[model samples]
Target: MKKYFLKLYQYNAWSNKRVLGTLQRQNVNDPKILSLMGHVVAAQFLWLHRIKGLPPPDVKLWGEYSLDQLLKLSEKAGKEWLEFVESNDNFDRQLTYTNYVGEPYTNNVEMIMVHLVNHSSYHRAQVAMLLRQKGFEPINTDFITYDRVITGQLKE
Candidate 1:
């Protein structure tokens, strides 16, 4: 189970860097794009803090960050998540955390890990659509693409 989640985190980090690189290469500093990416990075921190029994950071979920800021934050969050997954072995451990709306919920570590990746993927799709509408091609961040590239089946 730990191995599986580590692979997922690896994919997540790779895909995030791809998206960030695409945005940089396309010279896309769109507010919406930055905001979505910021939210993704912020949510990763939030969930990690919850899992680690730490307080949440002072960050706005929908905040619009500069492209450079997003790049740094995304990279930091990815590293932290990867390290957390590597150090932990109990994915089935349940955690209780409060939601943004002040609601309480309990979920196991596995579910939260899955949710973080899925949440990023969902927003990345939105970022891709926005880029396409603006006459730019988005980089492929699909899991299979990541797998292939890592395995040397496709050149990155």
Candidate 2:
């Protein structure tokens, strides 16, 4: 499970960098793309903090980070996730954390990790749509495509 999640995180990080880079080169100031990108990184930060049992009220779910800062924040979140995924001791552990609205919940680590990936994919699709409408070709972010590249099934 740990190894599987590590791959998923790798995919997540790869896809995010592509999207951020595309946005940076195209329209970094687009409000919708910026909002989506900001939310994606902000949510990741909050979840990582929660998983680490860190203090609440420190991370924001909808933080408005600058376009230039998205990559830095994404890199920081990737490092945090990689450190956790590299340690498999508690992969099946359940975590208890309160949501942004103060609603408490309990979820296993695996479920949380999967949710994080899916959440990012969902928002990425939204950003892709926005990018298309703005006459930009969004990066291909499918998980299987990423897997094929990583597994030597496809050329770079």
Candidate 3:
């Protein structure tokens, strides 16, 4: 289980970097893309804090961020999540945390980790869609793409 999650986290980090790089290369400053990416980064941090049994940070979920800021935060979140997954082996441990709306919920570590990756993937697709609508070609950040690159079947 740990090995599986570690691979997922590795792919998550790679895909995030790809998306951020594409945005930078295209000089994309679309407000929707920025907002969506910001939310993704913020949510990663929020979940990390929750998983560590800490209170959520006081910040807007959809706060505006400059491209550079988003890139930095995304990099930080990716590294931290990778480290967290690598160091923790208790995937079945239950975590109880409060939602942003003050609702309480309990979920195991494995489920939360999966949700984190899937959540980012969902927003990344949104970012891709917005880029396409603006006549920009979206970078391929699929899991298979990452796998192929890692296996030397494709160039990154």
Model 2 global lDDT (CA atoms, 0 to 1): 0.85
- Residue-pair clashes per candidate: 0, 0, 0
The superposed Cα distance between candidate 1 and the true structure at residue 152, in angstroms, equals 0.4
RMSD of each: 0.7, 1.5, 1.0
Off by over 4 Å in 1: none
- Give the per-residue lDDT of model 1 (tens digit) for 92-132: 98899898888999998889999999999999999999999
Candidate 2 lDDT by residue in tens digits, 1-156: 877888999999988988998888886578778888888988888888788888753545676667778889888888878888887556788898888889989999789989999999999999999999989888889999898989999874
In model 1, the Cα lDDT at residue 131 comes to 95
TM-score of 3: 0.96
Best by lDDT: 1
Mark the 10 consecutive residues where model 3 has the least summed lDDT: 52-61
Give the best candidate by TM-score. Answer: 1
User: What ranking emerges by lDDT with the best candidate at the front?
Assistant: 1, 3, 2
Better-scoring candidate (TM-score), 2 or 3? 3
User: Which pairs clash (backbone N, Cα, C closer than 3 Å) in model 3?
Assistant: none
